[model samples]
Target: MTKKAYSKLLATATTTAIVASAFAPAASADSKDFSDVSTRYADAVSFLADKGAEGFPDGTFGTHLSIKRVDAAVLIAKVLELDTENAPASGFKDVPARAVGAVNALKEAEIAYGKNSSTFDPDSHVTRGEIALWIERAFQLEGSVEVPFEDVNNRYKDAISMMVANDITQGLTETEFGVSALAKRGDFAIFLHKAYQAMVEQSDFLLTVMHTNDTHGNIQDIAKRATAIEHVRSENPEALLLDAGDVFSGTLYFNEFLGQADLEFMNYLGYDAMTFGNHEFDLGASADGHKALADFIKGAEFPFVSANVDFTKDSTFDGLQNFEVSEDPADGEIYNGIVKEVDGEKVGIFGLTTEETPFISSTGEVQFQDYIERATEMVDKFENQGINKIIALTHLGYDDSLQYDNDLELAKQVDGIDVIVGGHSHTTLDEPVLNEDGEEPTVLVQTGEYGKALGTLDVTFDENGVLTGYAGELIKVSDLEADPVVADMLKPYTEQIEAIKTQSIGKEAAVVLDGVRENVRTKETNLGNLITDGMLAKAKTINPDTVIALQNGGGIRESIDKGDITMGEILTVMPFGNSLGIMELTGAEIIEALEHSVSAAPTASGAFLQVSGLNFTYDSSKPAGERVQTVKVQDGSDLVDIDENASYFVATNTFTAKGGDNYDVFKKAYEDGRLSEPGYVDFEMFAEYLKGLEKIEPTVENRIVDLNAAE
Candidate 1:
């Protein structure tokens, strides 16, 4: 039989078996009556009946009935005892206005999230994998296990793994876990029973970890995550809400509010602890961004922790604590961790961040230490303080790169760290990754970026407060309802920022590209051409000698798509508040900069230069300084050989003028008074120039040529 047909047949047979078993003794004299009752639950009647769950009184269990999204939520809430007192106010638009209470209850308990906006599709069908995730969240298992399904990757793996580890419907069979299969009511009932039993077993220290990452200024998802965490809190008093960071910066809302709205929303959500992400410093290397961070800390109900950063030098943040050690009566002092009394047992928490923060972060004043070294030190400190259970809240990315190591390495290197709540790389761990470096297992997990998933690690410790085992799952935000208060708090900022972003700046006749992989620095995109072209246009008006303009590839942050482009979009593309400046250089100095550009071809190097009104060529096979052997000027007639004796006015941004991109040639230009004062031209003026053009198109016209072939 086909798989579909086989599944249907199995479902029917299972229901029949359950119904027959329920009435076998009493219906011995009435076999026909027993057969009549067997049609509803099919394979699931026994399990549902055993758990005191009854179907509609029509003598039918409705095993084949497709489970509505709302029903699935209600089932989880009912089974986990998620109710009104624990759930926050509902903000979802589609959730039945009256059913808001039930939805809020489930949200507060950390059982359901709306995904985006305050709109839950209550009528949607519930998938088998989804139900498993809910069950895992409700039960709170610990330890990282591989996901059973082959199709599940970093995205939904965390949820699937959690469900599998908790004994929730084992992915269709013992070996094959299909993440997309529809959940039959009978199967769902069985999973719920198993989860309920597990919860009952752990009635002592009911620990709930409600976590969200890569929030990116998405206030609506924050509300949903908060509601779900609250739902977990209702079941257990010792619940804690944690964020893996990158909460502020990214979207228009973040740029507009400058992290204020995010702070307010996070405050409303009641986050317990959070770490820093690279994007947190997008504003610039200034005290204003730090002030914003300080403001957030002041408003936060929980602590902001980062072990690698030495904030002692920054006097503005003197009040912020570097590390927190909480002691449990049974576990003693827990360093780099938080100890909470959950069901009377002590739970510990710690925090870490990526070592590449120094390179990626725009906050130049901030510094980062070695992640593994700092983590080891913190672990030693905490262990010395007598803390047995430890969890690391890490912002390190999931995959290891040459610049920085992933969290798996950290878990292996650190002996005492038990669990790691990870972010930065946006990896979704369905099951915890096993630490290859140590004997003890280190649970590593990350909810996907943009608050799309919630990660819950349900851990159980022995009587001595030493961690014994754990289970974890990632809950998708798409299935639950959003909380209203958080949404309301963000409404004004969202509307304002969106309006600003949508305001049209110009029209495009064709697609304007930006960066290309492998040659992002050397490549000439339509957007790059437009930006350099604008700089040239703006500079020639000031200095008639301006024969060419050069813009660093790194300075061109975004591409302008072919459509109604806007001033706001331009601002987003070039959010760094840099201004245009003019510099004078000889042909030899220009060649030096061009040589630097090709030195790092096929890899990202800040020194890659995009030029306007000049054509040059370089050979990657040649040495750095000798690569650019030919330089010519585009004089509207043909390529004329550059005049080494004559001075050329080069227009560039303030960043490039400061010898950025290894263009030390500009340093001589600056010292010679050739570097003019900052001009009126900025990204905004460029956008207006595009708007005036009505329709501008950019093409690669061999601006750079290789002289090696000519020779």
Candidate 2:
């Protein structure tokens, strides 16, 4: 017998029987009235009868009769919940008119096949081993477990293994599966019921989420993003379009329109929701406070979800903030979590912003709560609402800022989150990261920065809302044709940005400024030197006592080409609009900060510092936090060794002065009234310094020497 054909036949029969039984009136009387039905088969008969399954041709259920292949096909079809009403011809002359639909539906699903091209042998009784294969394939069951049945052979081993793993059956006996025995109506009912229960309980659910993160106001590809969104929606119409934040800063576009430009495209693309990224609060300390951020939130066509970010302190968000989870969330509002009903299933989505936001961005009074605590609370709140499918939309880095929080730690520590859409570290997860170490598995994914790619994730969940399988990948945005409507919508913004890009900053570079990722993040480069020198020079005009300047390598986004630098190039390099800050710190704190800076040396760290007015030597062989060997500060003309107890003034961006990039010492000093923000934007200051110099020729002068070098 062909096990494949048998399984499909059984599946079809099971389904048809269920549909018939479902509509069947309470068995002539109650199922208990059937004296011919055994206690074991009585419940099964009642279940079928209650659902409207007719008894065997004779009035009473023929419990002891061998169930025919035609009967099994109908039964399994009901079990699989397959549509049988419009099924085509079964191609078997012997098949009865009533069994034709079930058989054809089974064939269409590739769950069952005829005995031959033209013969279904519909009257043949299905065997125990045959039903096993049918149940396995019909339900798409998977797993490997030992089967002790002696009668089961290699051909049926995989099917039996899955059956055993799922506890679908225990065999005809402890050591026997009765593989060759013909299936009786009574026993088949019990097996079919179990299969039906499995179908109901472990049904596969498909969820597609199209996500992007750290777009950083790079709407140049918004049209392509729209195309990518539509492409995915064509395949998965119900796919959720989500952004993991950092849509606030970058490029000349953000400089001109703030976040309004990005918001327009996001609205047109129909984003489902967004979370708060650190850069979203970059303007918090501005004269107007968070008015821009408030406007951005107000202008959003979709709601925002961030459990840990408290906008309560800022009255600007008074009407927008909703501190509790919402079942019927409205657009243009904020919620701790929201219940989204997708195809009759409830999906819970919450958001988390990194707690380091205050230290990294000018968050003003918008407080950040502990991510783990808020996440746990959100999960509990969702579970209370009977929502088991939970998605944590977060702007926390994938593996960054470990001193505070990250997605990996969240997945391992949290219990219920099924998916994590992440950002901040700008990690490109070509494949979803699976973390099953927690009570339930969690899938983490992110798209890299600058709107270069769109991330797509297809996940499968069981009926119980447990993540079972996932496929995630980054779709290159440049490859897709731009959507005409979005392209038209983006033209005005692009035009304004293009005009800005062509406008020169009144300065020229004598040499190519090296600010490539590999070079700047690992070692000092000409651009790093130039940027830091500008920071020092700009700081001195405000505070002449400032002796050192530092800039994080990660902040230096791009290199300046050898020519007259335009506003676009300047903005591209220093896109965050970070302001200069002068901080008073003890020599020990500065030394400690330097140690933290080079800690990830050999492996480029975003926290790596590029400096001016100072020189430091670190031993890479030494462990992190202990790598610094010597530190020198320029005192008028001579470089003097740093005194651990002495105090010194340093110039850097406000982000670093407030302890961004795990610089806790700087945060302490900022909190202790030792840092002053001068309100000069980094790019503007660089432009000023460049214009003053007329032309630039900066080079690395051993400002930072690593003791351990392969050469």
In Å, residue 395's CA in model 2 sits off its true spot by 1.1
- Score candidate 1 by lDDT: 0.63
Cα lDDT tens digits for candidate 2, 258-284: 899999888988899999888889888
Q: Per-residue lDDT of 612-686 in model 1, one digit per residue for the tens?
A: 888887776687666775789877767788887777778888567756666777765654446653233356457
lDDT (C-alpha, whole model) for all candidates: 0.63, 0.81
Residue 526 in candidate 1, Cα distance off native in Å: 1.8
**Residue ranges of candidate 2 with Cα displaced over 4 Å:** 1-202, 504-528, 534-565, 568-613, 616-711
* Number of backbone-clashing residue pairs for each candidate, in the order shown: 42, 31
Q: What is the lDDT of candidate 2?
A: 0.81
TM-score of 2: 0.59
Q: Name the candidate that leads on TM-score.
A: 2
Worst window of 10 by summed lDDT in candidate 1: 20-29
**Candidate 1 segments exceeding 4 Å error:** 1-48, 52-206, 234-237, 287-289, 322-337, 464-468, 502-525, 528-699, 702-711
